[model samples]
Target: MEKYTGKSVLKGIAIGRIYWYRKQEYRVEKVETADSEAEKKRFADALETAKEQLSGLYEETLARVGEDHAMIFDIHKMLLEDGDYLDTVNGVLEEGFNAEYAVETAQNQFAELFASMEDEYMRARAADIRDVSKRVIRILAGIPEDGILADGPVIVAADDLTPSETVKMDKNKILAFVTAKGSSNSHTAILARSMNLPALVSTGISDWEAMDGKIGVVDGFGGEFLVEPEQELLDEMIHRKNQWVADLKALEQLKGKDNVTGDGRRIDVFANIGKVEDADGALEADAGGIGLFRSEFLYLGRDSFPTEEEQFISYKSVLEKMGDKKVVIRTLDIGADKKVDYFHLDEEDNPALGYRAIRICLDRPEIFMTQLRAIFRASAYGRVAIMFPMVVSVSEVKRIKEIVGQVKQDLSAEGHPMGEVELGIMVETPAAALISGDLAKEVDFFSIGTNDLTQYTLAVDRQNQKLEATCDTHHPAILELIRMTVENAHKEGIWAGICGELAADTDLTETFLSMGVDELSVSASSVLKVRKAVRDL
Candidate 1:
């Protein structure tokens, strides 16, 4: 038996035969073209072809994984159209190089530039450029695009996978993914998490081809991959896999069940969504409501800020789909890691602690008011609530209330029909949690963003992989803060809920119940699992 340890992207167990993922390799020879103009035209034709392919992929991915994940293809299309990228390719072609060679040159130059970036997110975009370049080059070389093919379900092993490659494969045939090189921040990793697939990255498995068709066990919870395991180990893994499957089936049974503890304490279970289409998933998962509708998604992957009508249409669609279910839409929380070029935010040494979320909204009331007016306008369609992110003080909440009040009045004066909307703030910072007693009085409820709360309370950079060990979500300090926030919220006659990654942790479900947490909002897929945990407690 051979054992390899790596970082786990999602927690699950899979026992299957190994399938080595290999893409066709194209060697672009540096051939001087007699007709430079013709070569440039060929490159342009290939770029157009690549854009069309990406457009089709976008529609397919959108139907499969919804908008947030599908936006990756849109980004790829944008990169193809980017002026700098086009200029580099054209400059190479100007030197009388073949279209294929020019594309390879541009790919190398752009990939190197992105790989050298300081920000990890930008660095990951290097793979995206490489993917796009390869697609265009394949067209120039007249090679058919390749995708992973397996006879049956198998654990996919690869050096690394690009987002396009991951999405192109038949997900039903993929039992798990084991990559020798990848980051948790990679788009492929995010897609794996979204698909609820077991994935291991940075495994350093160079001889993956040799293990093709070999029985493999992926222990995502333990961050271990077993190859050609002994009978004893194989049996143990089989047992664990069976147990995992059983647990999932049991969770399915809890779908329509109330999120009530054994002692008869009932709590609301909701789902956090990024796009309007995600409301369907939440409802399918039996989520009582939408806890955190990340409104910033509307602002991303676009040229400029979303107009009032655009935001209103998006919000109204989600609200109408959700009907009377309370949909808590968070105001624009774009900053820090989530940056937009049009925002023109300055570079900061520590962006997590810099201008972000409510800070940006407060600093630019024009942007904040625009979103508020849209949310209020959508409120007429169905139940709606507005939540502010990164609020740290009662004064900030008060200012937000003033803006919200003015927005409501403006809409009323315009004779727009509106429904009652609840106002709340995300208690993410230590200052917000510690001052929850006062801050709670200013809002209708408190939604603790444990992801930021834990990071802020421990002074740990959550995005830094090196600090993963120190960024403990279940730390006593974090629990105490959650407890304090919930207590203060109840004291002020306002309910408190958790709407972070930690909220989905079944292990912490009982602890949150003990803290009197009124609600838990997790991913749509985790709703039933969390509900099962609550009921079991």
Candidate 2:
């Protein structure tokens, strides 16, 4: 038996035969084209075909995974039309290269540019560029897009998978997925989570090809992969897989049940979502409300900032869908891992702790006010609360409140309808947690963003896979910070909630409840599981 462990994207277990996923390879050789115009025309035709394919894929993915994941195809389509990318491809064609060669050149150059970026999220974009370029190149070479083919259900092992490739796989044939390379933030990982598949990434398996057709066990909960397991281990893993399946079936029974402790203490179990379409999933999961609606999706994958009307339409859609449920939307938390080129952000050596989140909003109040106006306008439709991210000081909260007050007065003067909105700040930094008492007095509520809280407290970069063991969210310092923030918020007649990855961790669900946390917001899929934990406590 061979044992390997990696990062788990979802918690489950799968016992199946391994299916090595080797993507179709295309060799684009440089060919001297007599007519550069002909090659350019061919490239244009291929671009059109690629866009058509992406459109169909977008619709298909939208129906399967909802609009949030489907938007990746939209981004891919936008890249095909990007001027700089077109210029690079056309430049290669102008040098008398064939259409396929031109696309191949552009792919290598653009992929390298993104790969050299400081941020890990930006680095992941290299895969997108490669995926798009491959599509165009394949069309030029008269090759159909690739899809995984398996005779039966099997665990898929790949070096890595692009979002397009991940989406195109036949889900029915997939029992689990194991990859040699991927981050938790990768789109492939996101798709795996949305599909509720047992997945492990960054396994660093150099000889995965040799393990093809071998009996493999993917223990996603423990982040382990067993290859050609002994009878004893195989039986144990099969039993665990059965139990995992049973637990999922059991969790369904907890749906629509109140998240109350044995002592009759009720806690709000909310869901964190990025797009308005995700509200449907939240409702299906029976989330009490939305604890963290990330507002950044409005600004990402676009050439320019979203208009006030556009933002308002999205916010209002989600709010109206949730009806009377409280929806806490976090303002544009752009920067760091999430980058928008049109924002004209300066390059930083370390963006995670650099000029990001609230800093940008305060520096550019015009942009911030535009978003605030939209949220306030949408509030008239349903319960809405706005939270600022990466806030570290009382002065920042005061400034945000001052700006919000101005927005409210401006809207009132303009005769615009608005609602009673609650204001809050994300207690993600040590400074914010340490001075929770002072910060609590300025906001109506506090939501602990444990992802950043743990990272900042431990001085470890969460993106660094090598330091994963060190960046523990369960550290005593992080727990103490949560406790402090909750106590301070209660002292000021406000409430505290957790709106991070840790919120869904059932092991810590009781700990958070014990800390008097008013809410726990995780992904929509985790709502019932956390609710069960709370009820069990």
Candidate 3:
């Protein structure tokens, strides 16, 4: 029995046979072709065939995943039809290179270009190009496009799952996912989380092919994959899996129940969402509202900044889905860890403590106002609230409100009807928490971002694995800061809430309730569980 450890992004247990994934590989040889026109014709034929395949894949992916994710296949089809790709291949063909060699050269050149990009998402697109080119090459080489074929359910083992490849996969056949290379923030991990599939990423498993057809146990909770496990180990895992399923089934009963305490004290339980698709999960878990809609995801995978209409559409979708429920949208928190290329952010020695969040938005008012306009326009659809991140002083809040007022004026002049929107600021820094009383006077409510509050107060980088023990959100000092912030907000007649991971912490449920916290926003998956805890209180 061999066991391998990895980072587990999603928690679950899967016992299934291993199905090693390998892309169809073909070798190209440099050959002198007398008929250059014939070589060009062959290349064009292969490209057309690849385009057809991608069109079908796009439709399939749209049905499987949502349009946002399925757009990746559409992107691939565009790349194939690109004039650059065609001209490069045809140029190589005119240089006396065969069809296969020309295609290989063009693919390698474009793949290198994308791989060299600083943007991680753009860098990952190199794989998409290679995947598509491989299809064309296989057709040109007369090799069948052999995909991952398994007889029954299997745990897919791969180096990495591209956006194109992941969406094309059969969800029913894929019991779980184990990858040699991927991160919790990768597209594959995001897709896995959306599907509620067990996934173990960065497993560094190079011998996955050898484990084909062999029964393996994926212990997502333990972050390990057991290959050819002992009978006793398998039995224990099966029992644990059964228990987890039972717990999930039990949590289902908590859905649609009002998050009220035994003493009839009511508190709103909301979900922190990154994208519009998360609205479904929030509703499934019966969340009262969406507390934190991380607006950065809209800016992340794209080549340029999203337009006002684009942002408006996304915000409108989430607001419309939630209906009367509140949706607190955080304006572009782009800086520190979440960097964008077009923003051209300068290299800072310490980004967390340096310029980020409100700092960036404040400096770039054009960008900030565009986002504000979108949020205001979307407000017309449903209840929408705007929240600023990494705020420290009253001046920033005042300035933000000033800009929001200007945006409202601009929209109104354009004959756009505005909705009744509330403005809030995130108390993530110690400075913000200390002056919560003064800050509370300027906003509708307070949403304590405990993750940043803990990091900044403790002088610890939350992203650092080595200081994991030091970054304690449960520290008395941290709790006291939250207490002060919540107290200050209530004093000003503005409700306070916790939106960080600590909001869902059951151990602090009574503490938040005692502190007069009006709401707790956590992940969609934790809404029911947290609501259950709140009710039991």
Q: In terms of TM-score, which candidate is strongest? A: 3
Tens digits of per-residue lDDT for model 3, 87-120? 9988999998899888888888998898788775
TM-score of candidate 2 versus the correct structure, residues matched by position? 0.73
CA RMSD per model (angstroms): 8.1, 7.6, 6.7
The full ranking of all candidates by lDDT, starting with the best, is 2, 1, 3
lDDT-superior candidate, 2 or 3: 2
Alpha carbon deviation, residue 127, candidate 3 (Å): 16
Screening candidate 3 with a backbone cut-off below 3 angstroms (N, C-alpha, C), the clashing residue pairs are none
Tell me the tens digit of each residue's lDDT in model 1 across 294-366. Answer: 8866777543566677789999999999988999998988775655766889988888889898889889999
TM-score of each: 0.71, 0.73, 0.76
In model 1, how large is the Cα lDDT of residue 243? 91
Clash pairs, model 2 backbone: none
Alpha carbon lDDT of each predicted model? 0.86, 0.88, 0.86
lDDT of 2: 0.88
lDDT string for model 2 (106-218, tens) is 88899889877777567768879999999998898887667656679999999988654664577788988999988664555765764567899989998977799999999
Deviating ranges (above 4 Å) for candidate 2: 1-4, 14-34, 37-138, 141-177, 182-195, 206-217, 225-243, 410-415
RMSD of 3: 6.7
Q: Residue 252 in model 1: shift from native, Å?
A: 1.8
